[model samples]
Target: MSNVSYYTAEGLKKLKEELNQLRDVERPLASQAIAEARDKGDLSENAEYDAAKEAQGLLELKIAKLEETLANARLIDESQLDTSKVLVLSTVKLRNKQNGMEMKYTLVAESEADLKSGKISVTSPIGKGLLGKKVGDTASISVPNGTLKFEILEITRN
Candidate 1:
């Protein structure tokens, strides 16, 4: 069975758009490239044909992966989320217990993780440790560097 993924309404919409782009645009473009390459010369000796075939295979693999992700995705209702604890799609404010540094992040599905936007995957070490924690609660997370502690300052659905 495929692992279920939790996504907010906006996240789900973005996923759907990406899937559509891959199927409607990239797939057709790949097919066209293969056809164009095939017309150039013999299949065995043509480098262009070989390259195009490899590209087509990769594109199809990507499409299949995206389709699987969509099949297992579950759209979460933000309104139904409780602000009392950190969970998927929760925007959390935290303070480093060891160094007093403050940081904020939103927990999202792996597909939606974007460090530039301060969104972290729920499967990540910090995100996993923060889940189910409430404001004023402390979480000790194990990371590649070492174990770090964080104090939750706030949790809100975004």
Candidate 2:
């Protein structure tokens, strides 16, 4: 099962940076901790050794997962995208139908989604609803609260 994900250039760079940090900095630290713990006492009776071993295992698992994610990651070209409709990496400006409140969001990959940064995952309820919509198109999105309506004001590939 191969799960491919799309990301902007900046998002891909950030992912690579995190993977490098985990592999270069974190992996060595974990190994060092395990070695120091082993020098303390017998492995069977040493709680520090057990804890260190467990921590190393967890760190290795995280590194493996991150490696998998990076292996399947693809970088999207903003210039190649069509701004006529909402799509991955599309910065969409929306208007709330009821209140006329304007909001902007950048549709991104699941791992890159950050609400505080105005970036949303394409798999999210609002993102999914907004997908394939053109300017002035109304999207009825179902959320945890209920269905909410939004009008697509503009789509920019940035």
Candidate 3:
């Protein structure tokens, strides 16, 4: 079964680039390593040759998985996204109900999530809780530590 994943245009492009780099650069290197190791001694007794072959097999598996991911990837148009409610690709401004600390986070695909950049994956606990919530709505999210409350202050398409 194919697992379809949604990504922004930029995220899709990055995935393609990474796939290209692995196939073009890393694949060749793996092949070269195997060849060099094979030339050293008899295959049965050569530990280096065995290690190189194992590494090559791992690299091929990685390449195949990336190809599958690319095949199932879909691009999401940010312009068509609704801004009134929290959703994938929504930049939300929130206030912590307990401490009143205001913060901002952009909901994005799992591959694009970067906490330092304030982008959280839609499948995350906070993201799941914030989904479908509108401005002025309070979201009580259950986390590993405890349940935390956040007041939605604004939602934008940025």
lDDT per prediction? 0.92, 0.93, 0.93
Report, for all candidates in order, the number of backbone clashes: 0, 0, 0
Residue pairs clashing in model 1 are none
Clashing pairs in 3: none
Better of 1 and 2 by lDDT: 2
RMSD of 3: 1.0
Looking at model 2, residue 85 earns an lDDT score of 92
Query: Which segments of candidate 3 are over 4 A away from where they belong?
Result: none
- What does the lDDT read for residue 110 in candidate 3? 90
Give the per-residue lDDT of model 2 (tens digit) for 24-73: 99999999999999999778899998998999999999989989999999
Give lDDT for model 3: 0.93
TM-score of 3: 0.95
